[model samples]
Target chain A: MTIATFPPEPKPDPGWSRYFGFCTDAKVIGIQYIVTAFFFFLIGGLLAMVIRGELITPASDLVDRAVYNGIYTMHGTIMLFLFIFPVLNGLNNLLIPTMIGAPDMAFPRLNAVAFWLVPIFGSLLIASFFVPGGPAYSGWWSYPPVSIQNPLGHFVNGQGLWITAVALSGVSSIMGALNFVTTILRMRAPGMTITRMPVFCWTALAAQSLQLIGLPALTGGAIMLLMDLSFGTSFYRPEGGGDPVLYQHFFWFYSHPAVYVIILPVFGIFSELFPVYSRKPLFGYLYVALASFIIVGLGLIVWVHHMFPSGVAQWMRNLFMVFTMLIAVPTGVKVFAWLGTIWGGKLQLTTPMLFCLGGLFNFVFAGITGIMLATVPVDIHVSNTYFVVGHFHYVIYGAAVMGIFAAIYHWFPKFIGRMPYEGLGKLHCLLTFVGANLNFLPMHPLGLMGMPRRVSSYDPEFTFWNVVASLGAFLLGVSIIPFLLNMVSAWIRGPKATHNPWRAIGLEWLLPSPPPEDNFGEEVPTVISRPYGYGTGLPLVEHQDEIERRLDLQEASAA
Target chain B: MTDTTLTPGSVEAHGQHSGHNLTGFIIFLCSESVVFLAFFSGYALLKTSALDWLPPGVEGLEWRTPLVNTVVLVSSSGTIYLAEQFKARDNMALFRGFWLLSMAMGAYFLYGQAVEWSGLQFGFTSGTFGGTFYLLTGFHGLHVATGILLMGLMLIKSFIPGNYSGGEQGVQATSLFWHFVDVIWIILFLLIYVWQ
Candidate 1:
């Protein structure tokens, strides 16, 4: 007749086997995505090292042109598709339901299907390496004539496996997007309104909207390309009566917005981390959220920016130029907002916080470099050079990947009920940071000096920088060791983590660390006062009644 | 603040649509709209190019086959709407007949399109206009075929006692899908047959 304050004895759910489409345990699914993504991250990193090693000397020394193409192509593909997107979405799927006081995603079956489909699509892409001619040699962008004229494209794969891979991934993304949006919209507990949901959820919603709208174009493009290759209809071939430029138009149509798709959520993660670690509510929450939406919107129009030098009209070029420049304004709002969040608050220098701060610093430099590429004259010079390469790696690897690691380290306890080796995590962050800059920072100069991307080797003048870059890459490789060790060691013998290890005030803290098979015992969500009430003027007691209601609901259901 | 002030279920959740069928219809429209925009843009851009050629082999697309298909398709939309009206009024027999009639007319339209395709001289391989024509029409045809299949499934299910529960919302979702397909064909008819 008394409400138990804690689980009298850990009564894990036995009924979870019924929900078998996806891993019913949200934490398990989250870790599955994270660990697999981390594996790809290392593979991508190795490819990066291969690229740098080959470039270490001028004039085609280390690897042949074909292998070099495979290295960088798979590198970009794996990092973008296999690493950044999955890691972020995986984290979101893992965290958002728990964060918002929901027992599971509103559509858990769809969540399972989407998560599992990533590896399926991913293997098809990774499997391309062993194909007779080798992986998609037309570059990561896979621009036509070069891409379509090649023997191993969608047609020769004849299985439509390439198209199938991209589309399956697109399907996964669309489902994930829909689930993220619906869960945030419908399933929030009584008090958790639009304004009160976590910033990451808000960003995820915006990013997912971008995905839902943006991915269809890519799907349509891939479908058209598949038809072009398989059926000989000319979607992109002029000889077949299709224009290659049409493909570019359709391709950039998605790929440009995709840039935001990759970066914005990571930005969201940092947005959440900065405020939480700094012990401050996010500065300009409305602006940050609005900026995310604006970026998704404005991102659509700037696809032509990538095509400016490819013979687009001057006026069209200038139009995209202006839109491309305007992107900086919202981005500026975010940078200022983050700085504001960290400006005057108690700062936690935990490993996760270190990575967050490092990501911010690197992202600022990358943003500046991105702005430089937006200029007509500047882009004309560096359009196909290592500058573009360096710029993206900084954003994706330096900023987004770091943000993912920060989230993993920060939230590992919630998923696995054990802390990762913090000392190793810190060492990983430091080495990865130093090595990332050393590896990519000098490439800007190499690019300025006219070292082209996608080439096997460069001139002697570029030799020194490539060597430094290669050395840095090797260090980056070394840095990954700690993370892997930490993961393995934690899995083997780490101490069990306490619930609310960080004492963070979010609904996730209410659940058991590593959570139960059913997530929380209650099917219905209980309302909470605020998503981030810490450092706000709100009283802590505002959340207590709702928490008690959830506990009572769980107890009653159990009885 | 107390919980009493807020109404239960005030939260605006997605995935819930009623008789209006606005949400799914809108989503479908948005997707179709994007496809059409791509087609129109492709058309408009290509037409402006130096290759001022009509589809070379499509000289055989006599107006009659398309005009007849258009009539069949448009009338099926009306039939679907009438069926929805009858269902709303609980006229199960009328709903059943009209729904079947709508599917039949849809099948007839698709058959007409197939016959028309068989007669057409321009293949998808020929040129820009040819490729664009086949791609657009082919994609539209696929949608129509899917719509027909969905309606067939719904129609069969509706006949089984207690199968559909006379749910006002489920009936609306089906009606909306049919109406959407109907509207799409009207546009396709105008763009492909009449405009040319």
Candidate 2:
């Protein structure tokens, strides 16, 4: 079925109608991802507000413990699976082909299949909430022993559905990753060498490589867990002689690196944005690229950081601790390089740039607190507390979520052929910034004060900050209003954007707003300039001149 | 959009880079490797915790039949390569003969696996050893069955006059899959039979 539509274009092709069922147009597929993901983002946001509301009082009065369990499960489930990750992939689907000068994904049918599976899996997980016992209550991590016990009996059906849905999504991601890796490697236009490609493309490459190597462990682990629940297998049952710790080994082997999979592309987006807005080349471009790869390498070994309290071999714990800390080394280099890029350059404080800078600030706190959690002694004290909650949300909300908003504001013109309301964007950015930190930052201290997490309510002493956090969640809800309004208003009445409104140096800008059915006219040629070749004010090669001439000729002919 | 346009496929003049096929093959192999790696990972995780050493009701295979099947599977890889050579030389008859022979060899390998499975007193759902052994070889056999079907399709398509000829997309797809099956068999033989 036709899901959504963009406004008609200057260069409409008759061929597009034939491909309607196909949805081979990358922009259409990308829009499908964005709209679907945005809906889930709203649902997930409401779940969080409910959670904050319940925590506003000392008693679990707003909802019962079971309902609170479902609310938080849906919140984490929707945000992680349905919102943040999909937004990133949606952005990549829309933009990567244009950036690399390909017409669409290397495997078009596979791309369509990947997008289609998302909603199916997403719905199955959400459907679990309405079941008899509510959704999975084992927290988002769904750790074993605690996760395995279903005193709530919510365990069997709801959690089983959750695992299956996640596995389905895992397959979708793997297919997408394979297509991205092949297209980037095999189908890049001649001379678009790996180094000469856009920084975002490089990071996408690294992210997919992580997916390639990391996801199967999770899929296998899920199957084993399923076998345990459905069959009599003891894959994770200690009573059945299955070590619950083994499940941890398999889960984090994929899940921990999945954190990088979420943030690295966000880093890639910022990498592309900083250079364009700064009117300078990204500082230490090689180092940033290397840092992405190094993070991938470090991402693999640090899965055990999640296993610190599990009583693994002591030296093994120390080894994981050291590697976990070392991961920050590359991450720190990225933060420095971003700061350096913006330092002396003519920085344009566009809405997108503000979000990028804001992400950096939030990520710094996230990373430092992460370092705190990395130490074994600190982990034992803070493990499973609100402290852990505060740490992850900082990374997920402060880092990945802001990165998504930055991309949306930055790329809206290219996607929709119009500029969103600039004033509304700034307000959204500021309010979102304040609300998120106020909501999550106090969680750290609450955790430090020995307040356990995931409970519906707490002691009267914790009530004050809980109220404050709930107020911030309301403000967080308000922030999205401007974003939605700006987008809808821009669709109706905003001025149509020029081919390169931002004058960014990338192959995507070489085409019209909401690019054509074939992507390139007559011949979709390879790009020669580096994506960051801005401020040189020289066309990297004559191909852009030819494209400009062709566009002019086509316009004149139509006239 | 530069004037330095490289031809998309320069294989005609310089024969073939083998690198393109090799790279694509490597990527496919890596993905398949991860699936098997996942299964092996399950085995490793459960090794210490397995209920018993031998699978329930399983008996030893004769070893002679497995040795024969392994040799036959390896030899089919060569015969498939020969089929490709004949196709490149436009010898339709030779290509079809070798192609059909390779499919026959694959069938022989599958038949051998069936006999071996029958010999084992345990079935796939028996226990860890039974489950791992069946899943590993069973998955490989499925791949072999798929490969044989692909080969049969390719052989039939080759003789259909005025059908897309000589290094067409269909042929390339089939060849890629054949080589993939070959590589997986090598790994399965090592992990299941040879490694122990």
* Clashes per model (N, Cα, C within 3 A): 1, 1
Prediction 1: B-chain TM-score:
0.82
DockQ of each: 0.32, 0.22
Report the number of the highest-TM-score candidate.
1
lDDT of 2 by residue, A122-160 (tens): 999888877766677776767677556555544447777
Give one digit per residue, the lDDT tens place, for model 1 in A1-559: 1113332345554443533445745555666677678778878888987887777778787787878887887887788788878888888878887877566676666677888988898889878776677776667777776666546443445134556677788778777777777667666655667777777887887787777777777777777777676777766776655677877887788788888888888888888788778988788887888888888889989999899778899999899999999999999999999999899889989999999999999999999999999999999999899999899889988998888889888888877778888899999999989999999999899899998888986678888888888888898989988988998898668877776677576667666666765554333243445455668756432345554455445545644
**Residue-wise lDDT of candidate 1 within B2-120, one digit each (tens)?**
33233243233222313223343445356455656666566556546526346554463477878888888888888988998888787889998998898899899889989988877
> Which number leads on lDDT?
2
Per-residue lDDT of model 2, residues B46-128, tens digit only: 66556663554545435677888988988888888898888788887888888889899999999999988887777644555
Output the lDDT of residue A450, model 2: 83
Error of 2 at A34 (Å): 1.0
lDDT of 1 at A224: 72
* TM-score for chain B of all predictions: 0.82, 0.78
